[model samples]
Target: MRTVLVLTVSLLLFSCSPDTDDERIGISGDSFLIFGHFFGECIGEGCVETFKLTESQLLEDTIDDYSGQQLNFEVLSDALYQQVRDLPDFFPLELLNEKEAVIGCPDCADGGGLFIVYSKNGTQQSWRIDQSKGNVPVYLHDFIDQVNARIALINQ
Candidate 1:
């Protein structure tokens, strides 16, 4: 009976551990993906964009089914890709809430944006920030700017 009980408890603990083998990209997997929308002033269910970064290349896509715009794929230059890969690391996972966090005033007339970072160790962090108020976290703001700059490079 004692042996059986100990085994059962061990099995339960292993089962309860967090699962990180899902379809979504992992943070420390040499592949970084950032996807979200611009809220409060977007056309056709918000302007949705997704970016995936890897050591050798960068892939980007923009989709708007409502507007009948098809998926557009853009590959950035090697130099630009390298710059993006080296973006300063910010937001130590410990300082941030593991789950989605929404900060700042509610009625600040801010053009809010949603961002998610899939980090190493199968960790994920997301935030909804008010961009207009300029009260965003320094790391978060810089990361966003870096992404937008990459987008511009592709468009140009």
Candidate 2:
């Protein structure tokens, strides 16, 4: 009886643990997930526009139904906490207006965030937003939430 109970508890815990974060916020066909807020605003010519993403900002992208183990996490976060784990790191992120986080980090894709390397049948290669998002933990979370909301709208 004791062995059976312990096995059952262990199985439950393991099953609940997230191998990757692909369902927290906005989710698409690709195995991408977000978990925070997002806001974008700008002034073009004489017009001003603003957008905010809150509770509904969670987003997801699951490419070909691939998942955490298949994508591999250790390569990106370098044993960092779950908060920044398994993000892609594309080479010349600078061209995309990003920075190289560590030496010999190669490209962020296959590691950190989606690097477009894992593209679906006909998906766009990248996210081409205009604004820069500093690596503020709080801000990232909020942005994810806001993006999730947008994804939700698109689904409807």
Error of 1 at 123 (Å): 2.5
lDDT per residue for candidate 2 within 30-122, as digits (tens), equals 533322112222123212111211122322322212212222111222222232322322112232233432222212222222122223333
Give lDDT tens digits, candidate 1, residues 1-156: 999999999999987856634412333546455533344455653355555565466666555332223446578677766765643243233325434366453224645454444445555455555454366555455555655565556445
TM-score of each predicted structure versus truth: 0.49, 0.20
Q: Pick the candidate with the highest TM-score.
A: 1
Give model 2's TM-score versus the native structure: 0.20
TM-score of predicted structure 1: 0.49
Task: Tell me the spans in candidate 2 whose CA falls farther than 4 Å from its real position.
Answer: 1-96, 100-136
- The lowest-lDDT stretch of 10 consecutive residues in candidate 1 is 86-95
